[model samples]
Target: MQGPAVFIDLTLEDQAQELRKYFKSLGAEISQEKSTKGIEDDLHKIIGVCDVCFKDGDPNEIDAILNSIVSIMVSIPLDRGENIILAFCEKLTKAPDIPLARVCLQSLWRLFNNLEPSSPLRYHVYYHLVQVAKQSGQVGDVFYGVDQLKSQFAQCPPSSEQMQKLYRVLHDVLKDTNSELSSKVMIELLGTYTDANASVAREDAMKCIVTALADPNTFLLDPLLSLKPVRFLEGELIHDLLSVFVSEKLPAYMKFYKEHKEFVNSQIGLNHEQNMKKMRLLTFMQLAESNPEMTFEQLQAELQISENEVEPFIIEVLKTKLVRARLDQANRKVHISSTMHRTFGIPQWQQLRDLLGEWKTNLNTVQDGMVKVAQAQVELTRKQKAAY
Candidate 1:
């Protein structure tokens, strides 16, 4: 709870007095008449004063001052309110003190929340908020700020350049903190670009695909296929290459690489050998899922590796935890227990449905057995009571 209005008023009064002296030393004035002139003028003067005061003044006092100013600004006309918000945010981006900058950003956020969602100023405020939050290097702040910017773009629709900038910043931050989220955001940004500019969308899509494939940790290629820009490249060589990664085995990948060696080398800009290794792992996972047992010769044929390389490759696949299997080297076979599917498509869904149906049948059988046992016990109890 806050203190009484009198105390609040006193605090602002003290800060105002200190600000006036500070302004006077710099050959400026914060006269009482200026406060009474109009909200825009008052806001302008307050923003200028706060810009300087925030540098040297106590943080708590500056926060209180900013809160009071924002409260007054919220009640003004929309155009004036927007202009004041923009001005404040412009100064905020260059704020040298992180603590005071946080306080100021909080004040701006409070003001932004109070504004109607349709207000034009919301986008500008969100944009500046993202910029300031990025400078702060706080993950939570950057994440929330970028999300708000993205949401605002849906409503206001930023230009192609703005969309690109947001994507770059989001990618840079999320790459370190959450790689999966980075991939998701990259797809979303590509979708946005697809809608904004068709000519450049293909280029952006290529970049997204290259980045996804180049990252050693990213193995899921199915999500990229969902974007329209990517799908639009259906007949293109790149799309075919992506399809190879998504579901095709190592042999198919080798064939594609051999056929489009120049395109893969020049356009994709990835290590072909490393890609082949990843494809082999994914293909092994597929093999483990489809077959209960796979012979060493079958693995060698599918993965295109020699007998000497089979065990080491299997060990690598095992390390991924995508497959659980015991290698019977003496028998030259792999007895698969379970495996994680590389892609959860129609086949996987059908498999899940079948599994669920089997479980349901088993449950029904157990329930019937229990019902029979209960009936037998009930009959025995009835006979015993009759004898009694």
Candidate 2:
């Protein structure tokens, strides 16, 4: 079994016979029930052989062996699937070779659904699934597959302790990698588990991912970065989140810097004027959106800026496309047709309520005018009828 080059050169018939012989050495029988002890020993032997086969065997030989194992599990009766699953888990747990473990993982996925809800092997399967994925440089695929299995095996919810373990393993996997794949996987997990009953482990996994994202050592402005599931975290939690990017001085924060400027200078310990510009620009836009016509004096008073600064700030906002307004220097006012609000809170909500109320009042007035016009028409028609 040391060098499988000879096996690769063999004819199809010879290779099939050799595969059967290898399984026979592991005491594999034709779909029969055996003692647990007997099965464990056989599994150990099979794993040892497969480990060598993957190392020394050619691609064709390894593929053939994997295909044969899958075929045996599939052809076996439903009752026998558990044995194969446990055997594969055993191999996965003991095998130090990731290549061999990945190969064995294929069979585990194939036979996973066959396992019952009460099967003890489910834990073992997920445990190794995470490990193999983390070490194999295919963390995304591994976690995704495990997530599917978790849904399938819905009957057996892990204990709180077990959930913690699951979360920790996933955290380690995400913490070690900073690729788009890792970020996507982390985002998916956060979206999946962000409820009140979300396990402590799930929360830990999210923290681990967000920490990695804001880490200077592994920061990337990936497309998935903006989709971080932070709705479940608010208030001080959001503030604490800002500290991660602030301390790292990540450029990724430049886009939404206005929203988190509360800590830009005070807590973040960064002496950058960009935050001031952002805050002022954002407040200016909010005021313009809330008002259709505003005098220069009002803008200055609202933004706490000088008259000279008002026009320049408005011009900058116009350049940024944050608001659509015409500055009437002669009239000393701005005519705003449309605008965008960057952040929403109590002030914005209150503005929206007031605007809605005003809209309702205007609509009522229009309707009353229409009624009055209809009454006038009716009276004129009656007079014309009398004249006829």
What TM-score do all the candidates reach, one by one? 0.70, 0.44
Taken over the whole model, the C-alpha lDDT of each candidate is 0.72, 0.55
How many pairs collide in each candidate, listed in order? 0, 0
lDDT of 2 at 138: 62
**Per-residue lDDT of model 2, residues 1-388, tens digit only:** 1111112454443344555477555555422223245433333344445544554545455645765544444333434445556565655544456665565555455444344566655665676667766655666665654467467457777664565466556756765574343444455455454455444433544454455444433322222223334533334434344433323222334544556565544544443464345446555665665689999998877666798998898888788776798999999999998886544547868999999999999999999999999999999999999999
109 Cα displacement, candidate 2 (Å): 2.8
Q: Which stretches of candidate 1 lie over 4 Å from their true place?
A: 1-37, 45-80, 95-123, 144-169, 189-200, 215-217, 254-277, 294-321, 326-334
Worst 10 residues of 1 by lDDT: 1-10
The local distance difference test score of model 2 is 0.55
Clashes in candidate 1: how many?
Answer: 0
Summarize candidate 1's per-residue lDDT along 267-386 as a digit string, tens digits.
677789888888888898888887999999999898888999999987887787778998999999999999987788898899999999999999999999999999999999999999
Q: Which candidate is the best by TM-score?
A: 1
Stretches of candidate 2 exceeding 4 Å from the true structure: 1-20, 23-41, 67-87, 90-105, 113-123, 134-136, 144-152, 176-388
